[model samples]
Target: MASADDVQRLFLQALVSRRVVTKSLARILLKKCVEAVKAAKEDLDIRIPDNDDSVNTFVINLNASLDKLDLEIVPFVDGLTGNQVYVLANRKGDEVAQVASDYSPAELAYFKVLAEMIITAPNSSYCLSSMAALRETQSLKATFTKTHGERVLDTFVARGWLYKSKSGRYSLTTRSTVELQTYITNTFPNDILHCTVCHEMVFRGIRCYTRNCEGVLHNHCYAAYKRARQTCPVCDTPWNGDSEGKLKKVGEGAFVEGQDKHARARRRVDDEDEDEDETPKQEEAPSRLRHRRRGRGKLRPKGR
Candidate 1:
């Protein structure tokens, strides 16, 4: 019969192989690992329950085992989609630059700038348009052309470091949040905003409409908040749930009225090009849209 330690070792190896995985995927992997371990020896007598609780037990034990090595399995809900994700994260150090070990120095420099721009984007849009991203390449000291920059950005998307919207705007993926959380919070302390309801870091969410009110909530959190009270948690101002395009600068610690520039530009471009397939037929109307935007189109991050 395979011991519990055998199963834990197999699960840890799987997590190390895939640094980030959806909770559902992780659960499936856990089952597979148990099966593989059981097959390693004659395990017909000892039957381990193949249920969700098994994962919880495995995670707790594995984390304790990994504590000395400064590695842990971190679980977080995706701010945009609310899906649970598990990350094999390093618990020590703030060397986010070393996360993408495959990239060269020049590529790493480009990635840092691109990520910073997306993190500190104005109006809390937390997005970088394709044009704006490409333009940033010219300002980099490492000498990247628009073509090279575009390719690098594509690679980032492919490697799961960034999410590229159909509209051509780019934002950090949950993987980036998991791996770079420390660097992001430390470097952009003033830019980071936590949910007023859940208190988790919010990349995109609703903000209180009242000027000088610093309340912010994730979309899911806002839905729950609105059901009980139609007011901002921080300032007690009325909220009508139509607070879109009202995010203010993070430094001001307030809410201001304005639409996202990228969204506006995307609208303008769509209007100008009627034949464009910016919004595919498969997409829902903006009113019914969820996490991802139905808007139109950024920069080059290197060698993700």
Candidate 2:
């Protein structure tokens, strides 16, 4: 019987042989295998295990050998939903069989069980269900929130893994999809509406209305135009007539009859008081004017 050390040595030798496997390579291989398993599960609407038991055992043992390695192995016979295992096994029988043929009996058995478990019980407790759903870039943020309950969507935006459209939908960039897989897997957020000119969050803006035209200029950019030139710099559409630019006022009709009546009454009382005060002043002014005229007439006559 092979000792644990012997098994570990042989496994390492196989991995580092002509290929000279590095940690990165191992991660890539694991990712590919996981992806393949996920794909098979999705194609058949079930989980299928990797068919090489030897490989599975080696991976398990290899993970044990390295303190830093935290590999998760979904046991073929355990933790799967009944439907997942059944569907996976039924669809991937040939592939599993072929993989079993290439490996040792122990490895073959391990992989065969993995394949069966994946097919028969994909969502079972024993297996890690692959992310089978293909998420759109726009919906990633919301989905990410729903799935992980974390606010990692901002990180994606910060890293440019996601971009906002003028219409407020989030879409993934090509580089974003490639570099932010881990973040995406956690959760993606809805796309934000960013001003194309300023790259700032664009709420309802004048320049971002047309779906075909994603031109999102900042309010400052729009203000740069003269009154006659108040049109979209991108499309030359009039900003005044743009539906997005129309500001919707909230709670506009807050002042009703009672408030208006009170205000009108107070103004009326003030006007009446002012009129009363003015009448007395006007009467006094006439009398004073008559007296001043008489005095001036007397002085002038005497001088003449």
Candidate 3:
């Protein structure tokens, strides 16, 4: 464990040695790096986190380190989103760039508005109907037509910003969710707060449509609740089942290479979880086989 700490501790060191350190967790870890730097106080050459034990622990891609002139890393916590986002800030303390320089003004505006609408909409986490997104997008401005909005949304899905279902429902990818979290939380505080049914931060949920019921419940949780109680678990309001069949699941298409980066990342995290389970199962499988072989050997002796 201590040897592992040597590598992880170096990763902690590299993060702080940058322009600036942000995020509470990162800030706490920065102290260790500051101490290390002060002790060394000679030369520091940033290398990949997996280089060696003295500087190795977790693997951080060396390519991710961008070369920007006179820039510093700033940890930004937007007070609303519970996550920290790092930005390369200049002397003025403003973000150096908004990511790729190729995005047109129209594209940037369209992306933000669409992200806000999808994440802030009621029943968002369960899945916002694509039709609903179009309606909201059209309302962004007089000139923004539903057709244009649809194209923008399609572009977002293709670029891995959102997940589009075959049946035309949309869900936020982890990228969009993290980026637009502050907007979603601030815009729809009541909806995004603890689910009324389970008191959890599950915004992809359905609402109690019973005339001012205002109760929000997770889709799966509501499924069980509706089966047993036929009423809102948060409030005693009668449940309004999916009268319009909007909750029906639409099978999503398989992901392909060079598309849906967020999907790829999500699948990776899920794969990691499965791999953890497989390790124990693999050991158990071999042990079972060995036990069976021993039993056969005993049977052979009895035959003799």
The root-mean-square deviation over C-alpha atoms between each candidate and the true structure, in angstroms, is 13.0, 34.4, 24.9
Best-first order by TM-score: 1, 3, 2
The segments of candidate 1 whose C-alpha lies over 4 angstroms from its true place after superposition are 1-3, 44-52, 92-100, 240-304
Rank candidates, lDDT, best first. Answer: 1, 3, 2
- TM-score, per-candidate, Cα-based: 0.73, 0.18, 0.37
Candidate-wise lDDT, in order: 0.68, 0.32, 0.44
What lDDT does model 1 reach? 0.68
Tens-digit per-residue lDDT, 25-113, candidate 3: 44345346545544564344433222233221222231134224333343343222334444333322122334422444555655554
TM-score of 1: 0.73
- Per-residue accuracy of model 1 over 120-152 as CA lDDT, tens digit each: 666776777777777767766677888998888
Candidate 1: residue pairs that collide: 129-298, 130-298, 133-299, 167-296, 167-297, 168-297
How many backbone overlaps does candidate 1 show? 6
| Maximum-TM-score candidate | 1
Model 1: how large is the Cα RMSD against the reference? 13.0
Measured with C-alpha atoms, the lDDT of residue 264 in candidate 3 is 34
- Indicate whether candidate 1 or candidate 2 has the larger lDDT: 1
Clashing residue pair totals per candidate (backbone < 3 A): 6, 35, 7
Which candidate wins on lDDT? Answer: 1
